[model samples]
Target: MESSFQSENENSFNIYLKDISKFKPLKREEEHDLIIHVKKGDKAAMKKLIEANLRFVVSVASNYRNQGMPLADLVNEGNIGLIRSAKRFDETKNFKFISYAVWWIRQAILQAMSEQSRIMKLPLNRVSTIHNVGKVVSKLEQKLKRFPTCDEIAKHLKIDEGDVREAFAIGSGHSSLDSPFSNEDDGSLLDLIENEQAPSPDDKIDGYFLGNEIEDLLNTLKRREAEVLRLYYGIDCERSHTLEEIAAKYNLTRERIRQIKERAIKRLKHPSRNTSLRKFHQG
Candidate 1:
């Protein structure tokens, strides 16, 4: 029965791949027309736009396979981003739709990986920063013909050297815990490991529930305020952002970003708000 189920799943996946491959990419003019139709609530145009971009999502998701997520799952998350981009796309923009869609696809894929890939979750901001650090290193390597040092990367990003090192460490690929310790048929690494200090399974479960509750509470804030809080606290992501970084992204001054963040925190702490997450709050 298991073998039969596996075969059926494989067949289904293969059919999906075949369907996506059948979608021809849109030409520039055709893409513009589709965007217009989509803005006017044309479901057919939206479907076409999504179909034409499924291959692009696959391409982007492929780069993230090393992060331990299956390719199919990454592609699925990327598709969600593609649909979101289609809904929010500005037709008046000078750039191509694919270019705009790339950011959305990547953001979705990274967010998924941050939330689901590891037993210990990292913030999405840290995941994104690690990706940026890698890009910088690759660019510098091509220019200098050698791998750049952490200091060089820090200098380029205008951040501390320790941050660059930490990003590199966090971005390192994962290894199987059950893998053999050495070539000689010896014991696996899992046999020699110690996790006494790790969180208890029950604690982890409670934290997971609390995380969901916090997400619900965050929905009470306005969109921009929620975004500010998310970025500032690394609520759903791997790392928090500095006020300056948030300010630059939103085209606001650092002080203004700080004020917005504070206001959002106040809303979260207000007694009138939901009380379910009140116990999770720390002084």
Candidate 2:
């Protein structure tokens, strides 16, 4: 699946490269002359230098493919990095241009992650797996006194090593909620999402009263089930908790914890349990 995604990225990038094919690759002698002119504050030389090295920027950007940003954005960030490199490049560095510029490209990619990845989201299943694998990895780290290998992690999780490796790859990247899953895909995850309207003032007041009675409603469930919902929803636990943490606390698999939580929620939806809460709703 991941391989297919990467193939599409490469294909799309090829299409992009073809559009700017006139920017021929720079020869060493040609680069030297361009650098001489660039040192004299020649914008034409600078433009040529930037255009000539875009392929290198794309290659560098591909390294950050799974690092959160889309490949297109990664390339865009790398191009910015390349421009910065061009402006500050020392003619007498006695090194290849790409070797110097790679660091700047990576720095730009990391900076973009810091600025934008927060608002991005991945699918819930991927999120759950990432968290589950992370928890397992942490435990193994402590037990082994070193980072565990994929095989070691697989054994501990009773899953395939490839699955463990894939989880690691996913944990290192963030997919934008609006990004397409593949090049051929027509729409992004946003197509399925609707903007949530904030609660009305009257609704908020009713919710306040409902919160007071929620404890009584929850008490109808089994002790553990009720408490799991409380902890999961952060009713009184300060913040909503991840399944990984909740699983650890209960000494159960994360999947088991999720099942328990889901069952509890399903029970809550029954008309028998939410009768009092329903009265607060107008529509």
Candidate 3:
């Protein structure tokens, strides 16, 4: 049953790719007509646009198939992106459909990969750099039939070597041991890493709640006290809790709260910040 299902999936992908490849590239007049049809609520035109772009989607998705994802799954995700681009395409954007669609395609693929990959989420800035690095590395690998050196990739992407290595490291987390780098049978690369050591659920929860408690404790002070310590550590500089947030909690005017907190702080001892009671005020 599994084999039959796999064969059917493969056959469908091949047929789709063949049909998509046969589409004549749209000329300017043709594109204008399609855009008019789409804007006039023509579903057929929009469907045709998505159909015509499936091959391009596959081409882009192929670059990411090296990330140890199923090729058919990646292509499916990319097709969804193609559909999105078709719907969102604006004729006045002064950009070709291919250029605009590429961003959507990349976003869809990254979102899927991030969800399934080992490292979980990549921050927005890092996702773009990592995708670019993946493209460069795949192209280089195709040309040389081996992984490219960090220096070669850095040169190709016009990024620093350090960033190139870091991006590669993050992207590589997507692959299982069945990927190009492995020759082992005991377990996957991810397995080996997990075997070494990892924090337990209790430890992770404890660390999370401990940080939250510290934040709450910091907020318990007057606004000035919180701001002073937070800024001293680069914490709450942006719209940091106003004096009103603390004052309301203490049932006093902001000025009164500030005065009382000033006195309390002078008498308080904070070992972490190296602040002491004896330094500034008499009890």
Candidate 4:
């Protein structure tokens, strides 16, 4: 008898498995190339740009780039932005984190300027209001897919329009991270960023339902191969057994066990066999 998927998570898990099934197994040579690319410093590009920006405004990097702020002060303010960007970056978004973070880094620099010049400080309460306003803007930006106007933000925060305008006045316009919230004991706006990683109730319930379909696929392999994989990969075992341990248990040489492990891996990599187990890997 055929069984139907009982819940939405089951269906979602199935789709994720299909995506896994489409993965092409990497060859040893291809793996080396990937390592070489990463080693060649593609990942350091963002860090380099951040360093370059620090030497300029020393506070923020924007149209007002040559404010001649002290290098020590500039690095401090710029790094605050860098840390904030890492905290708030949404990996699933289509754009790069740096593009979204440009304003964050720049805003921190601007605040450094305001502090250095001893500009008029907003009252603590007003600073709190600005922080509240910034939170709404960040939320609404994601929801609306564009920067929300002051009126839109005001409505969302249920605060007055004048208050929103005051927050914007601190910068040439696009400033948010400059708000003076006493987030940590050090008094940074850094604490205002929200954490978005909690899984939903449905995801928790769905997590419990994974694994059955994968077990069914493993059942199709030769008994020895399937059992070996179950132990080697820790599919249903206490923990993954090393190839040598598995060899001793099976009364086989370590080299033979390794060959079996590799061959089984290649077999699982085949699109037809892999697609069968995609449902198992979904969780």
Q: How does each model score on lDDT? A: 0.66, 0.62, 0.56, 0.51
Q: Count the backbone clashes (under 3 Å) in each candidate.
A: 6, 0, 0, 3
On lDDT, the stronger of 2 and 4 is: 2
lDDT of 2 by residue, 1-283 (tens): 9999988987987799786676777766677788888878899998899889888777777876876678888889888878866755555533345545665566566556644653246666666666677788768866874446667878887888767755644343222222232334443322222112322223123133323345666787789888887766445432345566678899999899888866765676566765544343332
- TM-score of every candidate relative to the true structure: 0.44, 0.37, 0.41, 0.32
Scored by TM-score, the top model is 1
Q: What is the clash count of model 4? A: 3
Q: Write the per-residue lDDT of candidate 1 for residues 131-190, one digit (tens) a residue.
A: 778789768966874446667889998888878766744553211212232234343322
lDDT of 2 at 246: 77
> Which tens-of-lDDT digit does each residue in 1-283 have in candidate 3?
9999989998998887777788865665566578778878899898777776778788888888768687888988888867766665656532346555665666567657754663456677787888888788768966875456668889998889878756644554222111222222232211211211222232112122122323544655666566444432223221123334456755769787556544434422244322221121111
TM-score, structure 3 vs. true: 0.41
Whole-model lDDT, model 2? 0.62
Which structure is stronger by TM-score: 2 or 4? 2
Model 2 steric clash total: 0
Q: Give residue 268's lDDT in candidate 2 (0 to 100).
A: 60
Q: Which candidate wins on lDDT?
A: 1
Lowest summed lDDT across 10 adjacent residues in model 1 is found at 173-182
**Over 4 Å off in model 3, which ranges?**
118-283
